[model samples]
Target chain A: MNKFTEDDLKKELETKEYEYGFYTDIEADKFPIGLNEDVVIAISRKKNEPEWMTEWRLEAFKVWKEMKEPEWANVRYEKPKFQEISYYSAPIQKPKLDSLDQVDPELLKTFEKLGISIDEQKRLSNVAVDIVIDSVSVATTFKKTLNEKGIIFCPISEAIQEHPELVRKHLGTIVPTTDNFYAALNSAVFSDGSFCYIPKGVTCPMELSTYFRINEGGTGQFERTLVIADEGSFVSYLEGCTAPARDENQLHAAVVELIALDNAEIKYSTVQNWFPGDKEGKGGVFNFVTKRGLCEKNAKISWTQVETGSAVTWKYPSCVLKGDNSVGEFYSIAVTNNFQQADTGTKMIHLGKNTKSTIISKGVSAGKSQNSYRGLVQIGPRAHNARNFSQCDSLLMGDQCGAHTFPYIEVKNKSAQIEHEATTSKIGEDQLFYCNQRGIDTEKAIALIVNGFSKEVLNKLPMEFAVEAQKLLEISLEGSVG
Target chain B: MLQVKNLHASINDKEILKGINLEIKAGEVHAIMGPNGSGKSTLSAVIAGKEEYEVTEGSVLLNNEDLEDFAPEERAHKGIFLSFQYPIEIPGVTVTNFIKTAINSTRKAKGLEDLPAKEMLKLIREKADLLEIDRKFLSRSLNEGFSGGEKKRNEIFQMAMLEPKLAILDETDSGLDIDALKVVANGVNKLKSKDNAVLVITHYQRLLDYIVPDFVHVLHNGKIVKSGGKELALELEEKGYDWLK
Candidate 1:
């Protein structure tokens, strides 16, 4: 309203620095740079993993050695040198604290800067958090409250020691060690991630969350997460990540597997805001992840993600419906600005009768970045009366950016019903003028328009997450247009 | 309250409003009638500070202040409003929210706090009643899937809310039936006062019958060729625009 000219908006955008760009000076116990049999064994040994787990990682390492990096995504970047990445890195002194006051001050300050203060979150949102810093879980809050409900919530390493049966039963069942290139690599060297289990017929009273931070400079975060919802149970899990700005691209390859048995439901949400380097595309995180879930009879699985960071992102959180009357849903909003590139979407596989799936994806591309939504929906031969609906919309800020959609639908059953709709549009000058005439400046106008364009997916997020995601979208597109 | 002197404007090097001159005082309703390509909308756009048009030579002033350097929004904050002929459809933003943003933004420009929600809702309800608008219509996305008549009514509804010192209705009666035209004209009439003015640009004289402009001017080839009292509109209505050619 104070006459914010296009130049002013552009300048404001250029000055928008990454909020989570600070680095902590904690000493790291990191493995040597490079990926080999020795590195994998070292990571497994450092975790003090069991013999069977060690053997499983060795098998994954062998498969990863022979696999090739996927080149099918609609993105262009220099291939990451896997051999140059530190396979594992963690804080030298791990904190086994029972309360927030006992945690390290520096780590707590980092969380405060990221707006995930343990005390604040616990008092306000009632969300239990598992804080992971540099491939290790530092402190998990509200563990007692969760334990009272027969819920097992802790780091993966702790789970392996305390609840080995649950860890081993569903670790690689949905996403096996040989699923893909990144999954294989992550399976071989995953240092630490969150593990959640909900007992039979018990609904988790609070939202469970994991905050992942990559503090070390040259380390690659290979984290694996497993969530299991027993029969007639329900759980909602969310994860968030951020890293410091680096000159050399960092690697983040993660694997997450979810299992929901009969009459169970699981909702998984992610808000990823890793450092996306500088304006010239100098350095950022290269996030390549594989997340998938399995649904049994009358079970439901929903994946909602707001991806706004990473220099280059390649992920497809998918669902496999193997039981009758199962349902799968995906709602995503992927934003790319400056030199960032994102190729993220979902895959829904219908293998049983009366299966249903819905996919709503919104891609926003600004500056010179590229954003693509590549998804697949398949109905098998025995999937009688299956249904699938997909809507993909792209909003472009300037002429230099690009938004593309690739939807693959295959139906072997003649009774299946599938519908797909896609539209590509730019923020029109007329729209801007309309807002301008109404006394709204260009900056606020862009934010309003972009939020409106992404309302469908943003509405799918939780209340607090929706607010954060909206701010993230505004930040990502700042200075993207003049 | 508004003045346009020797207004020469063009877009993409093609001259549109060539040497147009106009003036409107407070408590007056003036209508500008023009044939196709006569630059009626161009005159309104140039006066509203649209950036696409290059002002070759001339000046537009509001309350004796030159408006050349003001952006469209700045002009709005300074009490100038243009009711667009085709309002943009912003999906997922309710009409109520859009208007709230506009009002709050203007208030912010004036260094004032946002209007209280209770007062804002009361004003909205009062204006909706004046325009005979349904309460449900205010909650729908702005102009998305709206009928043409509904869009015009919404524009006037906004004018009622903003209460600008100078309002330019560009082709407000183009796509409305007689009843819709009467409703819009009545709403505009209700908002008129001794301290503000209205400049109506239209191709038809039907709207003038309801609002009854004090003066009617014929714009031809980017110039006002004739000016007269309200009787001029009747004459133009009797004879087509070809008579002027």
Candidate 2:
């Protein structure tokens, strides 16, 4: 029996690797590494957008030029040279198809490598996916029924052409252009992403999902996603990201915005698995994203995420409770391994009377990984009877890995009530021995214990997605558990 | 069924059990009573192959086979059981799943076919009812958040399920109330047979009244200082371990 201590956990968490580092050998048309007015105009023209949409992009670009990169996050990185990054790249084999049958076979094979083959047995039957490869929406399934519900689900490019008025109404309503540095960059150059709108009083019957796979080398992906739930409507959305094996680092900067109007409800879930750099820290993905949502009077919005990839990740999905009796929630599990770094958490802004919010964050760090949780809870003067609760827990897989928590809470309304709690623990030898005595092996026991710790947040995901996320957690911690 | 000769052990470089000798035949029951730090539990831990306790100089024999060579699970597969003094909790693994895995692993080690799920379920139900345990308890995580008495009964339940040739109970009666003590004693008595042996290690004589050991040994300073019939337990109860020390 190996006596497990805090130090043993520290040892195992420090040995992470890049198993998905193999890249596809394909030709792609790409722009030069740099950002300028011409690059933005080229993207808008390539998508064949209307005049107003082009103007919107130009306006956002002007705002981005005035913003500075943020340094508030506890992350160490060589600032990415934006001007040296190609902002657009697309597989040359990709065909401009309007239906699933017209989609190219090679594109189908690409989704297979990502383990999501829409044509092969519909492994995710309950899920309707819109695959975004490089800088375009390759294929979208279950479109007709969703369309019948008055639900507008399509690529933002198509939305800009077909529903110009609606896109103009909510494009930057939740997250403005100058929200932050990464968001500003995303707003200025976001090439392709999903746009969904649930019409008033109509509930989306099935889960909506999308998969983002970055394949073009040196191309910085800027995908923008927007989901809006009108009055008395309900919807649940999920997004999963994976990249082909690549030795050279790929940059991914994306933004997501969600809005729930009066008496509406929305649930958003994400599973991020970009390729972390190799054991020697040679190459991987640099993921920087900003996601936010707003809940109106009698509205509710919940965010659940499982982050298990990226050589360096910096994201914080937050919620703004601005209407009376609105509610907000954030449940997240962020695991980083082998030279990976992450600074992620949530924010809850209480501005309306009787508003409520709940946040639960779980972080697992292994193999020289550095994981931090940064959150904010603010209660405004008008937020009478506002309440908030937050619980953050970190599990260290080894001593070399690090975990930290920084929570900011501000109260202005005397009637508001808030509570915060945090705990840090390592998987002990005694705990492992107890499981092994019952015949479970070391790897399985570690998986079970970590699953138990993250159960609260995992249960918030859609049933099918929750199971997949659990498997991802197991696979991500495979050799790290020992 | 079990034997120990010149069994010397230490923990963290400090000697806990000095030279000790003990033996038990099939169908026999032995009770060992001692004061704190007299190596009452050390003998059980050493025999069970807990890695922390070093066998500085010793030999443990089970059914004429050298027991010191096998791992803890190997000893279990060879028909040895140790009811822990304090059972460890394993969250997220149900008791039923754990016991089934244990039984199947033992079978696998013995080169026998694993029991089918149907047959195993039937076997579990019968043993659970005989021990008067709630069926729902089997669905909960193994020993997690269990009361002291519940933990003890769980140990007995596991012992019954395993049906080992040599069952060693280390202070199983310590934390139990009178009612739970009776339940534990009853379960152990039901498991006794002419083909197996039982060794009970305790610090009090109250437990001996129910199990009725054929022999009572007073362990002092890691060695058996006194050995006699069941009447020895009553004498020790009256005078206590001070005289033996």
Candidate 3:
């Protein structure tokens, strides 16, 4: 750095592009463009779903047709053309493989490039991975170990056939199909995702993870994930996502439901890194997700997410505390850069006596992006002594970028105690100079500062994913400073 | 080993430090004193390569190499350290983590491997003990909610860790009780060596009583109008800048 090398000799890029920009050209089984009742029925029928499941899809499709895309979020973008997007696109299927070696080499390479090698993950870590590419879950590792303890973990499509009673009982119960436009859409046409059922008194021994990749262009990925933890059981789930670079914006609508039964606990985390498009913002992913968890008496559910991508993001991972003494927690760090827009936060509904919830959200905006934290905390009637603490912090990297907060609190019970704190700040030039004077480069200094700003939330992630989340924060803000 | 030759600088096209010429060899301590707005801080910032001040004329050399093209961080890698008058707050970065990063970054810039964690721990323990900093204080967020004295003490702690060839302390004694100032000055004194020099910029002579400068230069307006032995600071302390003017 002291040598003052010429531009040609400077090895680093002046500005970084999305690292996961390469597209995989594997042959896929793509349906023709458009969505209708037939497409919903076809998606269910193609999975060889039961008659009741197909009926369920038809009902959701009817609900979706009547619902409209809500525009209450703080963002501006053109409406997506529903008729131009293919509802389902899956990698070309080979016969059931006994091991990952038999899986398509191209599919394996796609995961490899994303740094999630299925074979390595199986051997090295105690993390059970469900690899979902495009619209299908290709592999589920550590199934036998989980099955030995009466736990059921597999693809939702397979769950409908093999564990029909469990699927039938829990599906659409937490997140009803008529929840919203995107939820109804996801329910009607979700091709494939992961499903887990933890038996009573059984704690999952390994971290259950799902890696999602959208490789096929012009196709919408609607995935549904459901986790049911029985009484006194515990489970931790992690989700990660990425998409190939494309000029035409793609749509991603996913629904995740968690049912933590009495005395059970569930920790859910997501690292979302969909393409945020080129600097001029011509194309990227529109990530609209409905994620909520239901907690029974004495149950607990915690949702943590690090979102650094998606040109437009509208997500709120919420918790409904229907049982007394239940606990809810939402810790998030959302970073938006280069024309990206995000309106993401969490909701905590306290309906039971002594229910407690905590919300810590951090938003970092760089370039021309807009980031907002919109959250709600509701204390229902008869919920005596319900307590909630929420902190919303926003950090702006440049003058052009923006950070906003919208917090809604409703308390019907007089005994409810809710404390909320919010602050907006810009990265000070003195702070950067102080770091530079210490020999840390500006890029690394920004990362350090951001990590420090987001430490409270990052600490909630699993150790392995925490490292990746920190790196993603750095990459998302690279070249944002001069 | 440090040379600032006829330096002229400005901020927002307004001139500060119209002309400053100073030099310090190894094993020397230099103090620049003046009243308010005398450009003592501007000189320190210019030496540290802060972007705000545009150096209009003259050159600063460290070990015979001109430092015009080097960035603030590059200048840091070339052994220039500036302790700010007001330290910035990083809410969640602990002092231990910040110092480790600073040391490792300097090492990395020199094409050296990161110091092993064990070595880093030992160094941190030694420096913290020398500075009379409690172990628990190292774990708190850097400068967040810290008292003024704690902030200045932490700056000296960082200087001890970096061990720069030339350390510039800008108004290091602005807010300090006798006990805390002694701890800070003791820390700085313990780190001074034959291979490095110190530049202390202060408006008051209270700190110089402890730091004991070898040379004192009186600054008026943006220029250093008088230079003399360490007695110059004592004389100005009694007579004030009005006498010099």
Candidate 4:
């Protein structure tokens, strides 16, 4: 029998390539490098936005130029050149297609390879997908059901064209342009993203999802997503992203805003799997995103995310609980492997009486990656009898990896209650030997242990995403269990 | 069923099992008692193919085949089960799920389909009842926050579930209470058959009273110095291992 030593496993892990590294060859209508007032005007004009929307973009642009890139996040990388990045890029011949037959065959093939064809999704899973490739919203399925239920689901650009009043009312409400550096940049030059609104006292029938793919190199993807749940309504939204493998570092800065009106609820989920450079950490994506939600009286908002890719990630999805008896929840599982760095968590703000929040964050670091959980729980002075529970756990695979947790809790109310628990653990050899002595191989043992570690956060995911996330965790931690 | 001929094992350049010879046939139960640092646990770990222990000049054979290059899991698939003295606690993995994985993994190695869920649950329930374990304990995380006695019983529970051809109990009765010891001993006894063998490594003669061994060996200084019948256990209990040493 041939002996496979631990050194061989290490070598195998060092050579593992990104799974979704294939690129689409197509012509694109792209903007010239560098950004100015004219570039912002051109982007607004290209989208055929109304005058008020154009002015909003200009205002965001003016503030973005003055706002410096925030360095507070615990991630180190070469800062991307804003001037060298194309502000907007869209695949040509991707205009409004009434049916799949009119769509480009290559685009259809890409979606099929992505395993999320609109037809298959509709017939099998009933998930309506709005796909954005290189900043353009190409195809959105299941509109008839949305229309029947009095729901508004489409691209933000289309929403600006069709429902200007609604867009204007909620575009920059939750995550305003001045919220952060990335939010300002995204608001100014965002190409396109999904926009959804549930009517009052109604529940959206199916899962509304968006798949963002960065196909064009040298183009920064800045997408903006907004969701609004009317009074006594409910909706669940999902967002997933991936980019092709490239030698040059790519940038993805997106802003997402969600609103839950009185007596309404919103559940938002994200599975981010960008191309996280090669084993040597040569070239990958720099992901900076701003996502936040606002809850009205007697409303609820929940955010669940599984982050497994990106060379560097700095994101904090938060919820502002402004309603009495409101609830906020943030459940996240961030897996970093092979030179990946992620500083991701959430914030829950309590401003109303009897509000509650729960935060469960699990981070897994393998190889030479660094994974950190940074969270904040704030209780305002008026928020009497507020409660918050937070648990942050980190699982380290190798000695070369690092995991950190920085939790900030600020309570101004005397009646507020808070609880926080944290634990750090490694995949000890004793545990592996135990599993192996029971007939499980090393790879399967790692998978089992990882699944066990992230069960809490994985259980919060929808059925489809839970399975996918489990597989992703196993893939990310391969061979590093030594 | 098992053989260890001239087995010399060491960890970190220090030889623990200097040179040892052992052989056991089917349907036989052998107990090896020794004082502290007598290489009892090292022998079991080497048999189970733990990566830490290096067998300098040795061969552990299961049946007539040489188990030289098999990984720990392969050794397990070859029917070598080690009831660890300290079983690891893996949080969030339920006891039933852990056993199911272990069994299916072994089956897969043997080119067999996974045990069906219904049958798996049935076997698990039967084994749990045999070990006198509560149903609620089956759903809890494997050994997480479990009492010491519960942990040991859980180890025996796993041994019963796997039903290996050769089971090595490594100090499984150290922390176990009297009742848990009886349950564990009963489980091992029920699992024993004409096709299987057992190796019990303990420091005391208490557990042997419940699960009587056919042979008792005294190990001293990484070597089995004396080999005798079951009466040697009672004699050693009254006298001590100092005479053998």
Off by over 4 Å in 3: A1-15
Model 3: which docking level applies?
A: medium
Give the per-residue lDDT of model 1 (tens digit) for B152-230.
Answer: 9999999999999999999999899999999999999999999999999999998999989999999999999999999
Off by over 4 Å in 2: A1-19, A93-106, A119-124, A280-282, B1-7, B19-32, B46-49, B59-82, B90-128, B135-144, B157-168, B191-199, B212-218, B223-232
The numbered model that scores best in TM-score is 3
Q: What digit string (tens of lDDT, one per residue) describes model 2 on residues A1-482?
A: 01121223333344344434546665677888899999988988888888777787888889888888888888887777888899888766545566667776767666666667786524546677888888788777788889889898888887888888888999988888878777878877888899999999998988899888788878888999999999999999999988866777778989899999999999999998888777766677889898999999989999999998888888888899999999999999999887889999999999999999999999998888999999999999999999999999999886889999999999999999999999998887766654544444566567667777787888898886776677667667767754
Give the distance in Å from residue A93's predicted Cα in candidate 1 to where it truly belongs: 3.9
True lDDT of residue B225, candidate 2: 95
- For model 1, residues A199-244, the per-residue Cα lDDT tens digits are 9999999889998989999999989999999999999998888888
True contacts kept of 1: 0.65
Looking at model 2, how many pairs of residues clash?
10
Per-residue alpha-carbon lDDT of candidate 3 for residues A1-482, written as tens digits (9 for 90 to 100): 11111121122224377878898878989999998989988888889999999999999999999999999999999989998999999888774666887788888888888888887787776789988899788887888899899888888888898999999999999889999999999999999998999999999998999999789989999999999999999999999998988999999999999999999999999999999988898899999999999999999999999999899999999999999999999999999998999999999999999999999999999999999999999999978999999999999998999999999999999999999999998899989999999998888788889999999999999887887787778778887886
The docking quality of candidate 3, as DockQ, is: 0.59
TM-score of chain B of 4: 0.98
Query: Candidate 3: deviation at residue A232, Å?
Result: 0.5
DockQ of each: 0.52, 0.28, 0.59, 0.56
- For model 4, residues A1-482, the per-residue Cα lDDT tens digits are 00121222334345456767888887899999999989999999999999998899899999998999999889999999999999989999747877788877888888876767788888877899888888888787889889999999999999999998899999999988888888999988999998899999999998899999999989999999999999999998988877889989999999999999999999999988888888898899999999999999999999999998899999999999999999999999999998999999999999999999999999999999999999999999999999999999999997999999999999999999999999999999999999999998888788778888998988887777676677667667766755
CAPRI-style quality class for the chain A–B interface of candidate 4:
medium
The candidate with the higher lDDT, 3 or 4, is 3
Consecutive 10-residue window with the lowest summed lDDT within model 2 chain B: B89-98
Weakest 10 consecutive residues, lDDT, candidate 4 chain A?
Answer: A1-10
